[model samples]
Target: MTSKNNPKAFPLNLPEGDAELLLDELQTRLREGRRLFAEVGQILAEIESRGVRDLYGYNSIAAFYEHVARVPRAEAQRVTGRALALNSRRARDGTTIDPVAPLTGESASTGALAEAGIDRIVTVMKRLPDHLDADERLEAEKGLVELAGVARPRDVTMAGTDLLARHDPDGKPKDDPEPKRQRSEFWLRQKRTGRWDMRGNLDPETGARLNALLVPRAYPAPGEVADDRAPAERRGDAFAEIVDLAEAGPDIPAPRQTAERVTEEPQPAQPSEEPASRPKPTQMPPQGRQSPYRGSGEGVQESAATERSRNVAHLRPPRWWARLSRPRSGNAAQPHKPLTA
Candidate 1:
């Protein structure tokens, strides 16, 4: 088309007109790029069908695109994947036929769909369960593609997600938030100062599981009176109990035994020339000797003992050490004098 007739050409010396014209040109270029991108999928499909190594001496079609065409491996792979979905083909048995992405393929080639839109439609279509018959799959693909042609990519993705959920609502992922198998992390380390610092993140379900185990144990027992422990202290006690339970359980690993140093066994010692001397047993004291201060006669202690007892017996308290040790209770009671050290 001539420059004056071409709607894409921006007119010089007209700033407002140029802005509008530039925008239109950009939009047109984008549509044209999308159309060409869709066509490239077809070419990639043909390249994939024929062994790339045999035809072009490249190990794979992706290698050919990366090395020769300068296309990134990821983009090349995406193109090949989309192409396989678009192009209808017979299986190795030649009896079963693959369903072609009719709605997506046509819309993409006609520039009705952008890259994101096409991706959304393809994702929804592929996510449909295999148990669904061909008619069901076709209907889903048609609905998604129609949405993609008009809607923004974000809206298209949301719609795709909803469609997948509707089709197989009962089906769950392989790792569907199971408490036991789900990933969780915990880190507890003792610092040099003997204080423990713990930090970790856990999935919501995992956190719930931990709360279930700890909350009940942290609270005081029924009918108990003194339950004024702080929250942190209770949690600490609960954690200690958990560790005790773990140690008591059979699953805990045995402590590692340290290796002993290797050395030659000691030789037996020879017998001494002379026999060892035996200790002599003590003889009983003379039965005739009377015990000291026993009032059995022959011991000189009765006079001094009687004199010493008479001196200190009056100083003893009524309750022995009660005056020195007993706590003062009522107003009527006398204060106890402090005892000398």
Candidate 2:
């Protein structure tokens, strides 16, 4: 008999024959695989109920699984955790507890839902508001299971989220009041190296405000070069900019002057007991004393000397000039000759 076509074809070598038969074989094998996975969850559940530590001497079921399954600790924990959520458990008093998502567990056991779909349902059930009555919770779980059977994992997630939104509109219990205790905390410490270590926990409102302030500043500068900073680094720089803005804001008051400075008023000038000392007059450099600029350049020295001489000439004519200008005792006045250095 010819089998229906499957959009999802298995990657495997098949005998040359009807494509429909191959597709049917693929589908059958896939369903069997899912059934085997469900059986594994059941087995893990039994192992956990019996206590893996008591049976295998391992500290935890996840550790035991990691050793025997040859998987990473994280992966082992995830698998065992998922399995535990999907299977019924026994209380310390010997009472049997229902699986978190009863309908999902049943569907999974029957191979009607894949692992992904099962996880989605379990997550939704866990997040349901405590206000939901037992019957209402079961009904919600049932709806999700039905959806999981027909839809992809992502679609299942979306449906479950919508269902939760309807029940927990405010994202918390309707009957709970706002907490009185402060929920936010911050810590800052500077190391000997001058680098700062900052960490904190912020309540939802504070976190939202902080996010709004940093997001705009965290964007990479507009330029040809790509910003290679890690997201955390960019956020750090944004925080520093915020601090600077706060410090420079007009509303911030200027720092007060120190008391020492304010108290030290200029002392009033006291009447001098003795006559005020006469101001010392500047004396000319001694003759033949080299100018400080002599080694720098002749032009510098000459310019400085010429400037000094001009000042001197302005005050009174030089001796050489006066002697030259004075007529010889018996000679008539001769044309004044230019003075030479």
Candidate 3:
């Protein structure tokens, strides 16, 4: 009898080694399943099933590869093509098609499948048919979103969305200018297509030089500080200024002027008006019966003093009772009548 702790002369290498061996034997003995052959058979079959004809694109083949064979859509495409190519080469006398390579070709690591996976995906995204149903769009968009995982879609293409967003009102990402990159502010805007519309961002030195070249022409000399303009406006104005400067180079001759052009165009001045001729006459109606104040000197003095007294009484403040009165509470204020002279 073996010692209690002694290892077996022919011990199983690992706990699962027997299981792995069993699985290998089982795989070797098993006949290929109908399901595996079914999908492949359908691909070769001349007659399309009810909706199978609808699925004519390589995409359907891809989906079949993914769902049935447990491979990615991209790998499935490559494998399917390889399988077809291999099948095409054999004598046409009803020879059995090679099945193993097509399925197993996908066994290679996914990282090795395509040099420019992101690029191909972006191309597909751009070309997605606008007429596709909403469901189809969602499915296609899902694939695109996945592609953007490895590389940002915006980096790959910017023309459509970027251009439209700049010109179209609603397409702009926000009312404010797009966020600037940290290294140096470059112009960037989002497109409807979800790619970045990037104009070159100058380095700090280049930006300063460009700005210095642009400022006087684009922005009037007022403000005189870089901080005054919004980055968007500054960029826009700067572009306009650059075009103008390049178009109107330093050596271009100044616009010529003529005396005719310079002469302040004068209009005939308006004529002055003449004073009108008029007649003069004077008459008086005796006020208050040719007052005694005017006729006799002593009476005149007395009369003037009486009038002064009346005028002083009229000009004085409110009467005794009136002086003590105030308005009732909460009355709406009203305008007062003018005092009689």
By lDDT, the best candidate is 2
Lowest summed lDDT across 10 adjacent residues in model 1 is found at: 285-294
* Residue pairs of candidate 3 with colliding backbone atoms: 154-195, 161-191, 161-192, 162-191, 293-300
Clashes of each: 0, 0, 5
lDDT of 2 at 215: 97
Give me the runs in candidate 2 sitting further than 4 Å from their true place. Answer: 1-17, 173-341
lDDT scores of the candidates, listed in order: 0.64, 0.72, 0.42
Clashes of 1: 0
* lDDT ranking of the models: 2, 1, 3
- Which of candidates 1 and 3 is the stronger one according to lDDT? 1
* Per-residue lDDT of model 2, residues 149-230, tens digit only: 8889999999988997899878863577887887788887656564567789999999999999999877775556667777
* TM-scores of the candidates in the order shown: 0.44, 0.47, 0.25
Pick out the ten consecutive residues of candidate 3 with the lowest summed lDDT: 285-294
Per-residue alpha-carbon lDDT of candidate 1 for residues 200-301, written as tens digits (9 for 90 to 100):
789898889878887866776344356566777777666654544453344544323223212334345547875744222233222221212123331233
Off by over 4 Å in 3: 1-24, 29-71, 88-226, 230-232, 244-341
So what's the TM-score on candidate 1? 0.44
Candidate 1's displacement at residue 78, Å, is 1.9
